[model samples]
Target: MKDADFSDLLLIRKGEKDLTLGGGDSALAPVVSIGEWEARKEALKELYMLTLGQAPYHDIDPDLEIISEEDCGAYLRRKLMYNTGADERISAYMLLPKGLKGKVPAVLCIHPTTSMGKEQTIGNDPSSNGHDRAYALHLVEQGFITFAFDLMSAGERCFSGLKDFDTAPFYEKYPKWSSRGKDLWDVSQALDVVQSMPEVDAEKIGSIGHSQGGGITIHAMAVEPRIKAGVSSCGEWPMRISKNPFNAARTGWWVGRPLLRPFCVTGKEFPVQMHELLAMAAPNAIMNISALNDCKYTVEEKEFTGEAFRNMEENARKIYQLYGRPEAFKSITHLNGHSFLKEQRKAAYEFLKQHLFK
Candidate 1:
């Protein structure tokens, strides 16, 4: 679709019901009935794809390659690489539980914004400090086949002598595409890798992440129906409320896109809101784990406060209620500031298990 066509969908219309009511103040489109929601869902998906730059077709075979393998007692850990694009490969680590009786549920464990990338999720990088970030390892011990991979510009994908979070090289390679798109595309590809495994129950795949990874989990769950359930930790924030919505200047590129840059510069409202994005995953199981003190510094400034996060969850719950599966949508908050503590990790695993395992 043309940039103008996509931008037009984002324009707020008159005479629509307001879902945000007293929530974090933002212009959101009204939620319609189930039949209308089905059509609107597809439209919203298209708009999001346009905003992130449509991902190229992945027609090539994912020629999977195993670099090395080691036995870690309860599970076998393998360092592997697979094709995302015909010319592009993603480095990953897969933990397969030993002596599986049959096909079991699998989880795509996305790591936070650390230089260690997938290594942190598997507890292989001690220098990357955090509490129980080795969630991939923990899940594997719980008998779930877990796959963790390096996002673009992270882990082994990082350029020589550069940090993992750098996006300059990525933009240089694909100036029109946003880092967010690449991340989400890679995740869909990772799902391909995990689903192909003999020990994995392809129908029971889920995703979990914290911070940047958390944000990716949310987007991935929205677009990829293969993700039966997901846990997004401390990644709830409205793009319009961002100081530089849609990364207008291309600095700190996360959710910014070229098509939305004009709106950012003009200070105009985007057609969709964060709550609406979360709502797009209705009838499917998804949980938002927000920290009460998340973005503490900014909350002190009255920007993206915890109240806003709860408001987004509340508004999104309306869609779940419409689907008659309100229990499938859940959220929990803690006093910890931005960090995913051990207790939160436990809760996340339980939620995923409840949804994906049974």
Candidate 2:
């Protein structure tokens, strides 16, 4: 047999169409006025709700149960589990400062890419990953009440007997359900639990997360307006991609078969680019934290992301400006990699302090 003549499929390297969600002529522009902003916000929220699966229609009881409590110097730490939905329970750590009186600002400290889940946020995991620093403790020490919870597929909630990174099964099981949507709803439910606390100032709630949690933070703020301020660290910054599966080298771990498959349909893209998602958090004090060398993007991809970040900032700024709070939206880029480094952490804490506390 002649060495297999293989010009049919392997030799022709052209793809069906380019990934053109929001690029060139289709780029989104800043909305013109407050009225326009309001209209756009409502439409975008509804669109995302549909895309990510509508928020559970029924009420979630938020069954708050404190399993354990401990006095840890500057704060009191309590381990609790609460129902974020009819049957969805979230295990969390609630930190309350020792001597504070009256209601105080509260923050939801979301964990990064870790199987240990809420443990990383509360300093309980004891893992060496730099991203797992005890951010909740830092917030409590700074006099802010804080809550940290296991994201849906992480920690105690990983009922599938698989690692947290293995999230596709959950998505596959529920056709209309998405990990992102469930995570977003959990954030809202977390806010509900925080507000119910007499020591928490319901009007002064903020959220901060890194990596996986960081991406969720953006979506959470977009869907839940009650999040008064948010800080997203090195999450979902890349909006445009080459459409070629080979581009996996640049898309990182999120674009593979099954994980983000729902959003990765051929020739089509998410109804809105992520920058629009950033804009969805407009009029609220929000900050985007980026690592110049975050492991998620290649050098060229980083340049593309830098430009995109600037564009997103400008778009979101326009909304904040229309609301007469131009200073409320900010983006900070650092030299760190994908992990939640000290600089980003400090910046997040300061941003939350400026908006939620002041």
| TM-score result, candidate 2 | 0.82
Task: For model 1, state the Cα shift of residue 175 in Å.
Answer: 1.8
TM for every model, in the order presented, reads: 0.85, 0.82
**For model 1, what is the alpha-carbon lDDT of residue 46?**
80
Q: Name the lDDT of candidate 1.
A: 0.76
Top model by TM-score, which number? 1
Residues forming the 10-long window of minimal summed lDDT in candidate 2: 1-10
Worst 10 residues of 1 by lDDT: 1-10
> lDDT of model 2 at residue 58?
62
lDDT of each: 0.76, 0.71
* TM value for model 1: 0.85
Q: Mind giving the per-residue lDDT tens digits that candidate 1 earns over 163-233? A: 66778776777777777888887888898888888888999998999987888888888888899899989
